[model samples]
Target: MFSTREQKLLRYLMQTEKEMTGLELAGHLHITSRTIRSMIKNLTAILEEHGAEIIARHRKGYQLHIHDHSAFRSFLKIVAFERVNEQWIPSDPSDRIAFLIKRLLLSEDYIKLEMLADELYVSSSTVKNSLKEVRELLTKYELVVDSRPNYGLKVVGNELKMRFCIAEYVFNSAQKTTELVADPEMAAIRSIILKQTKRAGIQLSDIGLSNLVIHIAIACKRVLLHNYVSMLDEEIKNFEEQAEYLVSRQIVTDIEKSFNVTFPNSEVAYVTLHLLGTKMVSYRKASDALSPVNLVSEEILTLTANLIDQVENELQLGIHDDQELINGLGMHLKPAINRHYYGMNIRNPLLAEIKQKYPLAFDAGVVMSNALHDSLGVHINEDEIGYLALHIEAAMERKRLKPKTKRCVIVCATGVASSQLLYYKLKSAFESHLDIAGTMNLYELRNYPLESLDFIISTIPIYDDLSIPVVEVNTLLGNQDILHIEAYMVDHITLVLDYTDPELMYFQKDLQTREEVFDFFEAELTKLGRIPAGFKEAVIEREKVSPTCYGNLVAIPHPMRPLTKETFWSVLTLKKPIAWGDEMVQYICLLSVQKEYEDEMQKIYQFLVKVIETKALVDQLIKIERYADFEQVIKRMEEYGSR
Candidate 1:
């Protein structure tokens, strides 16, 4: 049997397609390089027993080699089951931080630092460092870790915030487990809540129902801890008049009877708060026929319209008339406002992936949130912004389907069977966005016309220069190959660039913080009379909301709103990487768009994404000291981008 560390190592290796260095693995696992080496040695022996081995190369580090996939899978299952049965004692810093938080959150007594260190089998100093992360996590929930000289530490905060934190972290695990509906108490409460909501003619989506169950469990836990949520009497009186309040009362009455606990007015108010905010019904058709003002409050409707207006005005996403988007935002904003009023943090586990995959939609969401902030005096958090992005992305998709589809041709070196296989694979992967014009063998490519074809997906390497881009891939296409082809199809809108200036493109500037980089760009633009005053303030405000680092050592910093009279991109290449939020960046593109212009900014964004997706281009561009070198790299990038 493998240790927990070894199991985690194996799982990570199996999932990753690229070879990982010892240092990279160490950084991800939060352990020393020495520990990584020892663990791999131990992991190798255990893996060999299951016909798997860890492959090591001089430059590429380690890769997993599995001879019998079924054997390795069986080994993994055994390890996983064993892990579940055993009490998990975390060894990694991040895991220890989570473990420490659960301990402090659930414990009624102060946990001594020495005791924690001893239990985790770490030094007191390591435990202390982990506590710092715990405090940071708590700070987001408006909770705190209080310490005494001898008694050690415990969590302290308002009862509401404490319960919210508990619901977020402690119940987050249970929400994943069958424990949520599988537990007898929770299942009964879920049934009662569903039955009562249905009886009252209130609509609760599957996710909303799950959310309500989690809140109910949290309420039960808090009540058991004698930490009751308190609400103002006047507010409770106002809620008593609403239909949701009545429904909540019935549900709470049933819950109290089932759980054998006394029901308080405050507890009833808590459930009512959820009911009032939860999505009542699908407003897609209603919003289309009648204005959103009829379904939701006039103020929120106006706010939603203004947000959509600003985003469409800037991005020209062609989604302003999307009724579904309008309905989604209008419906979501009502609850979002309620969440803001209560200072609740909505957890988004997909935030990082959302930013990576849907960068354009994410920016639109940020703009929408800023519009909400300016108009309604409502603060929107990143998680809520992510939720908004989903709606915006859906609207974008609807808009996309209206446009002409991109067409591509597939090339296979082998027999007709292989070509047919590759052709079908491409169709399955991109049936909606792409049109598979045809497939051809290597020799038949000579007569094939490339004028109308968007790009080429070739199973074999093509040595000949071609006008259209050709993505080399295996007969059984992989993810990276798909991404390569998709990149071309996506950027097919237009590859034109009118913003790059030799004078504005600075190369290899030694800068550190985000502020320093912004200050330098703002000063240069201001000196050239290219930007107005307070442009930096707008950029800073946007950065404060969410850092613009989009992975791949790239950061595209732009103002919260259009500040320049003309759309242009100002480029900066750092001599070395600097921390831009959580991601390290050496490539910076400062974007300043005009207030009104149907420009090809999306194409320019595609160009930037091209630069981001290719590390060779970024590395070469970063090392450039002259304009010629920078231009040369861009030329090479364009050449590679073209074919």
Candidate 2:
């Protein structure tokens, strides 16, 4: 029911809890101030019907206010399904870029820019700008856009490169992305694929199944157009013996009968390639659990172990013994290795969020990536690393919660009855996480052996210096007192980063490309003697491994390894956004660390993750022209994010 701009505006408003200014919205949507105002008026008109209205205030911008929550929710549901039922066209630059790429990729003939502009409801000049971005995106897939003056523009490249580009942009976009597909058609394909995969003893999650369905649908469409993908005789011979190939054949055979289309061996091979990327070992019964080792290959298992060991060597996460992690990583890596062998591309939608929230885990994933590169010769992209980080995160969670209780001694200055009451209160509060070692008086605290206990909970003022932390509580403890004791019992992983120096912060700097921004930072830092001679090269090398641009208009570029004598972060906010490895970035944080440092950096990483996670915070940081304002905004965000 809404235009593309309206949809994007609604989505942005929904994502932010605080009020957003028109200027902030304009920056994020890449539209002008006047265009933002016009779009907001249009959006408000549509939203009023659903009991929702955009509330505008002086100096505070606009926010969505709902008159009836139930009605607003119903409106959202309708919009979601409408996307599938109605013909949807992109209204924003990002979506339009994707649309243009898919259109150019699938079109048999050249498409005229005037026709594109007409269809998209944009000006000819806007279309031209979108095409430039399209050309940049195509370069990643090794594809090119060939433009002629009289005729128009068409995507031109190798047949294999074209297919890969289609697989990445067109098909992958359909897999749980914003692109809409007919529900009935999507559901039918998923059901058919599920039946075939189940019959073959291959397991896939719902999202994975949907992804496969899209791949098959693309393959079918391309085959009908006589745009078949063919592998060499050696590759085809090797694929014929694969179990996944047989499963793919069965799936294609049923699809052919239902869709009234015939698929050749090459098409079947193409389907098998997708299968190899997605198939997982089915869960076995407890009786057959001991034979689970036979599910995945020994090579993959060995590689998984090596990867875990590498992470352990780097971060010491202590997840190498987690069998579930080992199994999950092994299963994931099997298909990943297959993809590398054939140079296939896979996308992870959660990659950005994973990098933002789990920076330490992502760092460990980088270590695992290097190990995989050395052993399997497969270069790991950030998307694949995100999946690996998920497994590592799960293992860390398990390790943190493994039935281990803390031992503590409670010291009481009052009578035995009060001490007993405090003891019962502590037990009720901590539950399973704490074990009361014994109760002791303040006089007995001097002779008390505190080495065996994790921490001491005291009822009276005992100022004796001790190795273990001491929590002072009242004779009759309240909720706050219990919480205070629990704080010592629970190891807080929340990192409130306090590393942004006032001198290192640069505001509203005019920078162009990724290279230009890095160059500016290098020149500034080098002039101040803050970094080594090879610091810039170290940062560039890290980019070669993977771009540090983690989306949300933020990029935290750091060297592959520590290259500085001191650990510090140099931050710069650009006045205008620039292209940074397939994404637009404005806020840049150049991270540097001393070599062979032993400090725990979970807190610092958490802080950086917070910056990456919040769009409003980034908006606030961008508008700030002074270091004091920047620091104030960060402090405000820290307070808000904690809430």
Tens digit of per-residue lDDT, candidate 1, span 392-467: 9889878767855788788887878888988878889877778888888777777888887877788888988888
Computed on alpha carbons, the lDDT of every model, listed in order, comes to 0.77, 0.77
Q: How does candidate 2 fare on TM-score?
A: 0.72
The Cα error of candidate 2 at residue 355, in Å, is 2.6
Clashing pairs in 1: none
| lDDT, residue 15, candidate 2 | 85
Error of 2 at 574 (Å): 7.1
Model 1: residues with Cα > 4 Å off, grouped in runs? 1-60, 63-86, 148-152, 173-184, 280-294, 312-318, 403-494, 502-534, 571-578, 584-587, 606-643
Indicate the residue-level lDDT of 349 in model 2.
82
The TM-score that candidate 1 achieves is: 0.71
lDDT of 2 by residue, 455-525 (tens): 88887776777888888888888988977876676533332334457778888998778899879988999
Clashes of each: 0, 0
